[model samples]
Target: MNEPLAQRLRPKTLADVCGQQHLLAEGQVFRRTIESGRIPNMIFYGPSGTGKTTVARIIAENSGMTLHKLNGTSCGTGDIKAVLKDIGTLAGAGGILLYLDEIQYLNKKQQQSLLECIEDGSVTLIASTTENPYFYIYNALLSRCTVFEFKPLSAADVERGIRNALKKLSASEPQPVTMDEDACAYLAESAGGDLRKALGCLDFVVTAAPVDEGEKHVTLGMVQQVTRRTAMRYDRDGDDHYDIVSAYQKSMRGSDPNAALHYLARLLEAGDLPSACRRLMVCACEDVGLAYPQIIPIVKAAVDAANMVGLPEARLPLADAVILVATSPKSNSAHDAINAAIADVQAGRTGPIPRQLQNKHFDGEDAAVKGQNYKYAHDFENHWVEQQYLPDVLKDVKYYTFGDNRTEQAARAYWAKIKGEDKL
Candidate 1:
């Protein structure tokens, strides 16, 4: 069987790895540690194709440890035990390096089974996970391992990998395989930081390209044909989902329409219409509250339209909502007020409801006394009256502070006029 181009071009040394200069750059602590050949128990956390497995393999080779590869998706406690059984054999004499890929798939008990081996120095572990380690990892097991996050490769980094792959492919081909510069760039950019994906696309296009005058030519059209859509690394249940949603809301709250739309595009591209709709409604209320109170119902209509229409049409209403919220005058006064009131209530600072504010419907002997002094504000001028609505203990506490927006300031002026306060 033919080996995959990505596997054939896997980096054998740290110098050959495509990206992650943050961890593997010369003079860096991680690089220095790997060169020192005293590899520690560590976790490789990142998206796929960022060279975690490659780096782990390089470390094992340099350290002269007996590398034992196991994927958590396929390996269980019994498989772990099988590796442990070789602990005293000559095969394990140099120490065992267990490279557990997708370590998040292993349950707590399965993870616990390795604690003894790791603690005793019988096994040096390098676990890799695409998910956030803190959320999925067994805390005890996680504590024993140092985590190194691998970031997505930049277009330049991926382009380097593509160039290398082309060289290797050309050397093996009967006719020299060459790609247009634009094609190479397009392939690298479309891979979305996944070297494996870029290489795979390259492999397919090169194999399918026709030889012209003893030279195989890959054009920009060929690259486009192979990659109909750009690769996006988005897991609805994972970090990407939350991160994009957070960026979407924050961009609107920060009043950057372009950034808000960009994140909205990401969410929509991921087919996460529900999250986009939900967050837009939240941004309208939490970030644009009071300053644009009418926007609350307007965003609700957009959200309702989005859900009813669904994507590709869903993005239309959603984008309108995102822009409206992003461009609206911003305020968090209402959100802050509710949060402060909730905090006080949760902190047990709530005193009893005042007698006048209590329910007045009861027929008991004290029923008339319960709500006796409650003044009818409508009967008074300005449809307002001086009243203590908050519990006596919190009456002096100010929760709602008017935001400095025009709408809020106008309301502030009106209330101040009605209440006869000098300050607006």
Candidate 2:
């Protein structure tokens, strides 16, 4: 039987892998580990088509261990125990490497089955997960494994893989198969850093395009016909979700309306309306802040409208919210001020509250407590009185740094006037 393009093109060795220079480069820990033939329990986490499975196979081959592969999505503890039993048959020989794919799918109770075997060194385990191992894998299982992160293939890497695939197809067929420059670029760029998807699109185009002059000529139209559209990698339960949202928030903070709108569109298209609005709300408070405090209510109302309308109509309100936030004068003073206060309290800087500031309206007011000396600001000039509001320990600390926007600058001037100073 003929193998699929992805399986047939799997890298036979570590050097054959395309990307992940951080891990596969010379003098790296992983290269050293493989060369030393000391295979440790590892968790390879990344997006699909990043060579996690291929890397695990290479390690097993280099280590000269009997390899047993299982899919965590389909296999259960019973399947694992069966593999362990088979490995026991070769106790005197070198141990086996159990390659578990999608190990994040294994539930907590299921993961516990490997604990004893892993601890006793009966079967060395290598697990791969598309989701973050730290969040999905059990803490105990993670503690036993050395986690290595993989990144998506670059456009250059995808192009290289496509050329290699074309070469293989030409070798097997009577006629040469070729792709035009435009077609190749389109395929590589539209794959979204996924080599498997790139190869799949290449296969589809090759099969659909008509053969001409003893060769199959692939064009931009053919590539578009096969691909239809490029997809954004935005899985709500995966790291891509967090990554895109981070980009969206950062774009708003950096005041790039174009980039911010692009990410917002991606989020809403992925049916993550709630997350999209929630991010806008965060940007309204954290980025615009006191520079445009009124924006908070507007953003909240926009988000509410988006949620109420949902989908087709939600994009309108979301777009409005994004523009309002991205174009507004940015300031983080309110956000930073709260964070500084929190840090101080967390670090044990909290002190007793001033007696006069305590609630005097509660039941019996005593002289030492609520009856303590307190100045009435209404009776003073300018409706302001000089008094210590912060705890004694934090009296010298200034948490709010004035921003460069007009509103904040005006507020800063007013505060200085009340404090009898020209500057904070």
What are the TM-scores, per candidate, against the unseen true structure? 0.94, 0.83
| Number of the predicted model whose TM-score against the real structure is largest | 1
List where candidate 2 sits over 4 angstroms from the true fold.
Answer: 1-3, 25-29, 173-175, 268-271, 298-324, 340-381, 384-404, 418-424
Q: Where does candidate 1 clash, by residue pair?
A: none
Candidate-wise lDDT, in order: 0.91, 0.87
**Over the stretch 396-419, how does candidate 2's per-residue lDDT look in tens digits?**
898889999999999888978887
Pairs in clash, predicted candidate 2: none
lDDT of 1: 0.91
Alpha-carbon shift of residue 161 in model 1 (angstroms): 0.3
